[model samples]
Target: MAQRMYIVDDDKSIRVMIKNIIEDNDLGVIIGQANDGEIAYKQISSIYPDIVLIDLLLPSLDGIEIIKKVKNEINHDMIFIMISEVSSDNMITEAYEAGIEFFISKPINVLEVVTVIKRAIESQNLRNVLNQLKNTYSIDSRKNVTAPITNSSRRNTMKIYSELGITGESGCNDLANIIEIIVNERKTNNHFNKYNMKEIYLELNKRFYSENSIKTIKAIEQRIRRTVIVALNNIANIGIEDFSNYKFEKYSSVLFDFSDIRLEMDYIRGKSKQRGKINIKTFIEGTINLLKD
Candidate 1:
């Protein structure tokens, strides 16, 4: 079934542009729209769309407020995508903390809007599947039988790294090692958000080298960074060849920041002189999320 979406931007032009994009791409049906947060909250509560594209600065309640109210009062399952011209990190972070699945900056790019919406839909679908599996297996501990799931997840992770063109890189092993360490840590502590990247790298070095030296940690970090850059180049090249390629679509914004991917694409097309920046933490966290069964 096509995803049910709602538009909640004050600008009618943006709403029209996004609605046109959704219809043209056959992405979904727009079930409702609102020019202000008050009306949006009312319509959204009544209509219960699967996804909401909302402007951050709406009259009366604002986008984040609407999300909180919907989540708290209505108890509906809705994915929110914030549309804004604001570049302030704190505001963006606040929007994320309010439960938005993604954010789109103003002066919308058609390609970006399409890509992000598709990604959001795909992520929601995956969550649904995972939830179904959890419900099926939650009955008994002995009946859990997670070996097949574990193997399948490992294969999928390896395939993603292969598609990113990192399978042959030396740091591929380091990346795999990091995933293993995180999985093990989560099994014990139930989370790994407390540790920083530097600490993770130190732990990785200690696991392999029996000692945590700065030089070893630095070397591991450099290898992983270089490998990640190579993956970025490969993704940029794939995107240049075909923007709608499956691998390009799947890994572009999920594994790295969408802005960085766009910058890399521009550099590959010779439209820009600078290359993209790499965030090891984002890459690792994204991989971990994908690895989850």
Candidate 2:
């Protein structure tokens, strides 16, 4: 589906650069733009974007607050990526707690941004797949089964989520929440399947845009593997001796190409020339010290 995205930043150049890449690469649709925190929050709540690219510091509100408040009030399973100069460990943790998918430090790298956004999208989809299985299976396990005794779409969805490594992401939880929202929407709207990616873009645009601003149509594209790297990095923290573990094989090989998880994996872990089956033990005792300052 053509994903929907919004950019909230003060710098016109940065906005222009992002617009060019998104449009050139054809990542998704841009519904609106906001210059600061307050404006962003207001616009986002009303528009309900799939992903939000926000700067850390803004005129009215800071980026952190934007994430905090949006997550708090709207309570949607939206993806929030922080692009800022802030490097405090506390701030990073806070963003995670507030439900941000990833943090990109300033002097925003276009290539990096592209990569991150793409991973986020794939991760988000996986999140949806995972949640649907939880609902269908959890219910069938307890309440249904004898109620209908029909097809097994839920099983298929769960397989996709596991195979996709959507279960491995911090944002996986948020994605579940989003899937719930989509499911509810589907119940009331009979035309849900009729709305393909392009239709999804239009729906987002109509919700976010009340006026016709040319700048609102700016394009945004992703590198196709940025967030996957972040996901792998997070998984690495879970544990890995070399790269032979199930997690390594899963992220590096199985789930690698969804959004091209390779970019994010390469970015998170140092580059490895060897591709096929890895040789390291998956359980390395607290090797994170080497990764520390």
Going through the candidates in the order shown, the clash numbers are 0, 12
Best by TM-score: 2
TM-score of each: 0.48, 0.49
Number of the predicted model whose lDDT against the real structure is largest: 1
Error of 1 at 108 (Å): 1.0
Q: Which regions of candidate 1 fall more than 4 Å away from where they truly are?
A: 137-293
Off by over 4 Å in 2: 135-293
Alpha-carbon deviation at 44 in model 2, angstroms: 0.8
Error of 1 at 142 (Å): 12
Worst 10 residues of 1 by lDDT: 132-141
